[model samples]
Target: MKKKLLVFTGSPRRDSNSAILAVEAARAARKAGASVEVINLSRLRVNPCRACDRCRDRGPGQCVQKDDMKKIYPRLQQAEAIILAHPVYWFTINAQTKLFIDRWYAFGADEYRCFKDKKVGLILTYADQDVFSSGGVNALRAYQDIFSYLGAEISGMVYATSAGPGQVKKNKTALKEAYNLGRELVS
Candidate 1:
């Protein structure tokens, strides 16, 4: 059976640099015989987690929020790997991606058992010269910690510096790395 992979684009801007890179990654994954789905978070009406603790009582992947996340919960459970692609905002992950991650608390009932052994990939874009100056390192660290706590296996991470919209398309190396990341995760 083909590996299932989900790519979530978190940029609020359409055709953003990060989204472009994610597209390339998804293409490569599809070529590698993995089934890929790309979801644009900006277009979805995913509400912030209310921390009501209802999901704990309800069970894993069960959130009280009656929004787009309700649909995503099932997809998340089915996917073998997930890639989070986003541009740095305010020295860290943007609000859209952060909100999505926060809602993962519903899986806490099982201590994130579903994430154990699952593959994870990260793609980050920033405007500054490098990761340190752009604070991409902070976002990377956050992902590291988050996935670690969930017992997920981090397949790879691809990041780049793109100052403007769609600038990442010009970054050949990052694009290649993103493609390789996708293939590697499925392998």
Candidate 2:
């Protein structure tokens, strides 16, 4: 059977640093024999969750929202690995990414179990290169907590720290890390 990866990018602009790395990672995963699907959040019309918990009531792991995510939900269920590619904002994930995560609960209580043992990877871009910055490590930790709650195994976190969108391309160390992270999906 062919393996598959679902990559989600929360960057609001096209070809942002995070999106660039995400595309590269997807390409690497494809070369590694995994089919890839990339979701650009900017193109979606999803909204934040209203804390309705309708998914729990559905008793079958279905999101109540009837928008664009309805289509992606099934893809997410079938993915062997999920990748969150995003840029840092306010020392954490952008509001768009966080909103997506929050709505994930609409699937089902046990629906989250599908993530069990499945691999997850994170690609983060930020303006601060300082590892100790409130935005750097904290963002990773926050995501770790969220993914863990859903039983997803975070295999790796690839972060690009620089001042500009394309600056990551020139950062050999970060690029190597991103490639290695992509390689992990196959291993």
Candidate 3:
């Protein structure tokens, strides 16, 4: 069976550097024979978790909110692999990405069983010279902890410093890394 990979783009800006890399990765994943879907979180109306603990009462992957995330839940649960591509803002993951991830709390009702053994990939684009200066490390660290807690394997990460939109196109190394990450996740 073909591996199903879900790619989430967290940039609010259109054609953002991170989104560009995500597209590149998705293209490569498809070429590698994996079934891939790329969802733009900024285009969705995903609300923040209410901390109501209602999902725990209901069951795994259940949320109280009636929003677009209702559609994402099934895809997220069924995917064999997932890729999160975003830009670091305020020294951490952007609000869009954070909000989407926070909603994953619903999966916690089942101890994140849906994530066990799942392959994960990360692509981060920042405006500084390096990860440390851009605070991209903070986001990476958070993902490390988040996926580790969920028993998901982080297959790869590609981070680049692109000061403006489309600048990441000049970063061949990062682009190559993103392509490799996609292929690796499904392989």
The top-ranked prediction according to lDDT is 3
Clashes of each: 0, 2, 0
TM-score of each: 0.98, 0.93, 0.98
Q: What is the lDDT of residue 165 in candidate 2?
A: 60
| Candidate 1 lDDT for residue 133 | 92
Candidate 1: which stretches are off by over 4 Å?
Answer: none
Tell me the tens digit of each residue's lDDT in model 3 across 1-187: 9999999999989669999999989999999999999999999999999999999999887899999999999999999999999999999999999999999999988999999999999999999889998999999999999999999999999999998789999889988999999999999
Candidate 2 local lDDT, 1-187, one digit each (tens): 7788998999997558888788788888888888888899878988777778777877544767678888887888889998898888888888888888877777557757777778998988888757457386887888778877778789988887766667777877877777777778856
Best-to-worst ranking by lDDT: 3, 1, 2
Measured on C-alpha atoms, candidate 1 has an lDDT of 0.93
- How far residue 163's Cα lies from its native spot in candidate 1, in Å, is 1.2
Count of clashing pairs, candidate 1 = 0
Q: What is the lDDT of residue 182 in candidate 1?
A: 87
lDDT of 1 by residue, 1-187 (tens): 9999999999989669999989889999999999999999999988988989999999999998889999999899889999999999999999999999999999999788888889999999999999999999999999989999999988899999998788888889999999999888888
